[model samples]
Structure formats: structure tokens, C-alpha cells
Target: MEQKEKQILVSIISSIVILASYSLYVYHKFMAGNPGIINDFRFWGRAFLILIPVAIMAQIIIHIIFAIIHKIVTDEDLSTKNDERDKLIELKSIRISHWLFTLGFFLSMGSQAFGKPPWVMFITLICSGFIASIASEGAKIFFYRKGL
Candidate 1:
């Protein structure tokens, strides 16, 4: 209906899609005996490069869905509609994500002191970092919506 509503819906759906895909990838890797996504960073790097188009398409889809929702809700032509609050929330979430990732990286390195395989620690750190970042952002959004 409203631009805000459309944006919120699009954001939620895109997040769900991304998280689902990532979970499936993790499950597939586990079934294939890889057990960890980043254990094969070389392969992941190439795959990530090749999947850039998919990522772009996902973004485009998110925008398109938002546009459609906006049209349906307001019966108005689609136009860019964003506000400072949205941007501020996104920026803060990204900052938290970065900090979580950095902490995870350092923890992975610290694992080396305990004689763990570098690859294992690295992969574990990456997975944990991603999960933590996503969880943190989700919590932030939840709190924001709950009037925290």
C-alpha cells in the first residue's frame, strides 16, 4: 500500500530468500561431505564471481517486487521513495555486521593458538560471522519495529 509497507515487505522477502539459499547451500555442502562452506575458498571465490549475475538479479527482483506492491497499494506510478530513517537503520546494521565479521575473523585466528587446522577455523569463523551478522540485523529490525 504505502511506500514504507512495500519497502518493508520487499526487504523481508529478499532476506528470506537469501537466507534460504544460504541454508540450502550449507546443507548441500554438508551432504557432500564438505561440512563447511569456506573450507574450499578457491572454489567459492570462483563460484561467487560466476554468481554475480544471480545476486544482481535478486536485487532487481527485490526492487521490482517493491514497485509492484507500491503500485497495487497506492495506485500510483512507481517512483523512488526512501527516507533518512531507512538509510540510517541500514547503515547501522551494516556497521554491526562488519564488526561481527571482524570479531569472528580474530576468533578464527585465535583458534590457531590451540593447534586447529587453519582451514577449519577459517571456515567456521566465516559461517559463524555470517550467522551472527544476520541475526544481529534481524534483531535490530525486530526491536525497531517493536518500538524499542
Candidate 2:
């Protein structure tokens, strides 16, 4: 596998781990104590706000760690340069991510319009974001493998 592929795989894995662990932590820390908290708009708002920074920081740290390990194992630096093909692939993947997130946003709003609980909408939104991220990375892998 190429270095870019390896990096993408690492990103995908780290994202999944970060999201799952953070979710469990939040559930146990807050929702587990009082299930009613799930219905609180403030709780959801705070959770979303906190999750953004936490995810960003965690991703940066995980990537940094991966870079260090990769260097140690391979004795070579990962390429940071992007050629035309790489840029094109990235653009395509980003388009996919954007559309998926847009759809998710609409679906979440639709759920609320249909009388679903706020928590349902929030969960839908979160799932959509996660799916979009995974799909984007998957697309990059596919494009790379297919020589796009």
C-alpha cells in the first residue's frame, strides 16, 4: 500500500476510535447518571460544542503519533506534497463529504419536522457526520486504488 493509503487508513481508524470512545465517555459521564439529560437542549448543545474541539485536538495528536511511528518503522518521511492527481482525488472526496453532510442535515431537520424528539435529530446529525467522514476517506482510497 502507498503511504497515502496508510495515512488514510490511520485517519479512518483514529476517527472511529475517537468518536466511539468520546461517545461512551459522554454517555457514561452525563446521560448514564440521568437519562433525562438526553432531552435537554443545553446538554446537546454543549456536547456538540465540546466534541468539535476535542475531535480536532485528538485527530491532530493521533496523526502526529502516527507520523512518528511511521518514521521510526519505515525510516522515510511521508510525502506532504500533492500533485494534480492527488488534488483532484481530494476534491472529489471532499465533494462527496459535502453532499453527504448536506443530506444528513436535511434528514435531521425532517426528523424534527415529523415530530421526532430532539435527541433523535441530534443523533441523526451525528451519525450523518460520522458517515460522511468515513465515506470521504473511503472515496479517497478508492480513487487512489483505481488510479483516478
Candidate 3:
């Protein structure tokens, strides 16, 4: 278990947790309402206000858990010393993530152009961000496994 692999694991887990929890929350809080919430700007506001901070906090906690696990497993510091190959792997992963983000942005725009609800567009954007993150972290793990 390399540092990057641990990081990728944390990232994927965090994405799954945050997205699933937010989706469930939205379903219960907004979708379960009498008239529903698709057209409501308050829906968008609440989603943003809740999801962003919650996701950030979840990631922070997940990283700390990974750090503790690494310490216990390897008896080594979690702060890894990055070498040239590590840097290259990270750069390549980021390149892939950038493309995903660009695509997601366009998807959001297309949704809006088709007269989709604000909630739908925001969902597209949020999903894209999550996908971008997972793809980047997955690429990093792949590169690590493939020997950079």
C-alpha cells in the first residue's frame, strides 16, 4: 500500500459517501415535499450550502483516517517524499481530470440550454466534480500500479 494508493482509496470512498448522503438528503428534504423542489431556487441554495461544506469536511476526515491507518500499518510517516516519478504520475492524473471537468462544464451548459431545471444543472455540475475527482484519483492509482 503506497501513499498514492491509500489516497485514491480515500478519494473514491469519500466521493461515494458524500454523493450518496447528499442524494438521500435531497430526496427526503426536497423531493418528498408536497409540490416537489425542482423549480425552487431554495433547493439549489440548500444543496450548495449543505453539499459543499459537508463534502469538504468528509474528505478532510477521510484523509485523517488514511493517515492514521498508514501510520499503524507501516510504522512510517504518512507525509510521503515525492520523487520525480510520483510527480509525473500526479501530473498525468491531473491532465485526465482536467478533461473530465471540461466535459462536465459543457454538460451543465447543455442541460441549461435544453431548459432543464436549475436542480438538474446543478446536479450535473456536482456529479461532474465528483467524477473528475474519482477519475483523477483512479488514474493515479493506475499509474502507480502500472509503475508510473
Q: What TM-score does each of the candidates earn?
A: 0.59, 0.97, 0.84
Best first by TM-score, ranked = 2, 3, 1
Q: Write the per-residue lDDT of candidate 3 for residues 1-148, one digit (tens) a residue.
A: 7667877787888789888988897788768854556778887788878888888899899888888887898898876678898899989989999999999999999999998877778888888888998998899888989875
**Top-down lDDT ranking:** 2, 3, 1
Per-residue CA lDDT of model 2 for 6-78, tens digit only, reads 9999999999999999999999999886999989999999999999999999999999999999999999988
User: Residue-wise lDDT of candidate 1 within 73-110, one digit each (tens)?
Assistant: 77887656556766676676677777777778777877
Q: Is candidate 1 or candidate 3 better by lDDT?
A: 3
The TM-score obtained by model 1 is 0.59
Candidate 3's displacement at residue 63, Å, is: 1.7
The lDDT values for all models are 0.63, 0.95, 0.84
RMSD of each: 4.4, 0.8, 2.1
- What candidate 3 gets wrong by more than 4 Å, as runs, is none
